[model samples]
Target: MGNRLDRDQVVGTALELLNDVGLEGLTLRRIGKELDVQAPALYWHFKNKQDLLDAMATEMLRRMNALQEREQEAEGGSGTGTWQETLAGSHRTLRRVLLAYRDGAKVYSGTRFTDTSYAIPMERFLAPLVRDGFTPGEAARAFYTVYCFTIGYVIEEQSAADDPGRGVKGIDVAERAERLAEFPLAAAAGAELFGDADAGFEAGVAAIVAGIAATRERGRKVN
Candidate 1:
């Protein structure tokens, strides 16, 4: 009898290949080859490339879900900190997880299955706004801003890793400093903006949370 491959085994292999070859290079044929099985065998578990990608995406979200659940539990089953604190912690945890593999955010964002990862956080994040007197629609919009900032930030950060020299190749800093001297503020802050993603991520999350609160207050006044 042939060795029956389980779903976990298959998805695990796919993840392994994803780390090794990235999304573009991942294919059923390649996964099968890695598994020492026929390509057709993979079809028994997944319908197509998208199906496989969705499974992988779900697996990643599963990890995030577990982490957040434990985090919430540690807070005595409620998000005791400020909403910014809760959300920033989640973002930091996510960045660490995604950074563990090659093309992690690409695998995450490129796949269509974000509901598993998003739904819980969405609920947790929006609840504060709703409790604070914002309408559901307003809260939803705020959540989108935070979501967009985090996702966009990670994608740009990871893409930089692929190109080496931190994506500023062949540019002599001394020469660039002379050119940027006309813009003193830019020269002073450019390094801060680019240095240390952990700090940047926290700062961006803080700004977004503040923006959300301010927008909610404005909406309350208009109402």
Candidate 2:
């Protein structure tokens, strides 16, 4: 049996099957069937579904890192950006990667990383922020703030995007406008909230960055 599969191979198979069976339906036994092996084989690599999930999230992080590396290479390395831009851009790539797979954002969120694959790139982005006056803790919080924003946004985005495929209802702006017409402000807000996803995401990033910057300035005054 091909039970001698490595961790990455196991994770790759799981992600491939993720699109078809989706997160809830994915299983080690199902993956073994696909690999033509006994379920024990997968256990050699993953002791539990959560273990497998952590590895899968790490693999996703690796993919995000690889894309950033390529972008740096294309720009002749040591790619330039302010700390805010750098942080925002990292999560933007994360959003793209998460959106690439069915329930990808769901798979990623709340899953722990199995390795230090995120360390290097995370360090790269955190450096400028730390040097610019934010403490390591503050910088980490900022990164996480944007990271959570990206994940939450993509989760909603995926839900909305998936509705049509499964004949489900989604964020129908026109319908919302009509239903909430009694409250003109609430009705009009739908156009901004769900109308232009790209713009909405950027606006969120900008607002978060601005908040971080404001906190940093306040800290400077206190010091």
Candidate 3:
């Protein structure tokens, strides 16, 4: 496993450890063991476990940016789609990436990337919103709105998926049905209230994007 370990190598190994052991079990000592190096060797690359987690988060963003670029290229350089489409696509990609690893959303939620490289993707995403009439600050806020929503959604999704028992404790399908039976409207609503997660996510994304557009239009009328 020795090929002259570097920061990227350390971070890469740590990310693998993350997928295997999750955020709670991950530690520099564990990562070092996986890399066949001493715990102190990791400090040479990352200051501490938090720094390693930040690096992992940064790597996730980097992969997403590269994926976006590839998607745009596949579209024959015409760009990925309209601003709304692009934002939705990016959010979906973020969710997929986060869900790929154990506690991924939680790890990313704790990170504060010191890497300036993330600015590339940030600028690329915001440019369309700004061009579409949002001020730079407005564009940033809009992006943050969607980004935070996606992160929170993924966190809940992962938590439920990882521990189904914890999610619906005492609420089995039959119990859920019985509970709703007393409420006529809820009983009739049925699966619509708790099914089709993808549709639910898309509906939320559409609402946010439309809200941003509506705000932009209001600002236009005022000026």
Candidate 4:
């Protein structure tokens, strides 16, 4: 047990263990054991489990931002696209990052970022919206509207993928469909609602972007 263990090393190891133990079972003590350090040693870097989780979330964002940058570079450059494009792209990349790890949405939900690296992407995301006439507050609101949707969507998505009996699948689609056979739409909606995760997520994001765009036009009318 060296006295010089750094935060990144600890966080990195914790992430390594996450897919196996998940957030609930991912204790600081467990991480310490995995790192071959004492639990108290971890406190030098993080105050507690929540603090460590925040750090984990920050690391997740770093990875997500990296993926976004690489994708942007492959496409051309990092220039911000239309507000809708940027917003939609942000959700797509974010979902991929979260789904990459088990209980990732749990680790991400309600965790404050431990660093300022998020500012760069936030700046790039907000710039186009600002140029398109969403006041800073409105732009921020619009971003969160979509951002929250993505996080929540991934949460359910991961939950369902991990355990099919949970999430929307908890409902007995066949039984309900049989009971509601008299109603054509009710009988058929279950498969459509629960099927095609990719198409469903993209459709929801598209709807949110349309709403945000509508707000920009409404603000113009007000001004």
Q: Each candidate: RMSD to true structure?
A: 3.7, 2.6, 3.2, 2.6
Q: Model 4 segments beyond 4 Å from truth?
A: 1-5, 164-185
Writing each residue's lDDT as its tens digit, candidate 4 over 1-223 gives: 3343588899899999998887778998999999888899889888889999999999999999898888889989756588889899888999889988987888998999977999988998899889887789988998999889988887777765456454443455677788888998978987666666678789999999998777667877998
State each candidate's clash count: 0, 0, 0, 0
What are the Cα lDDT values of the candidates? 0.72, 0.84, 0.76, 0.84
lDDT of 2 by residue, 65-183 (tens): 99989987888867557888788888888988997788899999889998788898889889878877678998899999998999898887777554633211257788888999899
Model 2: lDDT of residue 157: 75
Off by over 4 Å in 3: 1-5, 163-175, 184-194
Highest TM-score: give the candidate number.
2
TM-score of 4: 0.88
Q: Give the better candidate number (2 or 3) by TM-score.
A: 2
The 10-residue segment with the lowest total lDDT in model 1? 164-173
Candidate 1, superposed: residue stretches over 4 Å from native: 1-5, 75-77, 114-118, 162-189
Worst lDDT run of 10 residues, candidate 4, spans 161-170
- lDDT minimum window of 10 residues, candidate 3: 164-173
- Which of candidates 1 and 3 reaches a greater lDDT? 3
lDDT of 3 by residue, 1-223 (tens): 3343588888787778787787888998888888788898677767877888888899888887888788778878755356787688779888888877777889889698858888988878877777776789987888889999888877766666555453322124445668878887776554443444567577788999999888878888998
Which residue pairs does candidate 4 place in steric collision?
none
Q: Which stretches of candidate 2 lie over 4 Å from their true place?
A: 1-5, 164-169
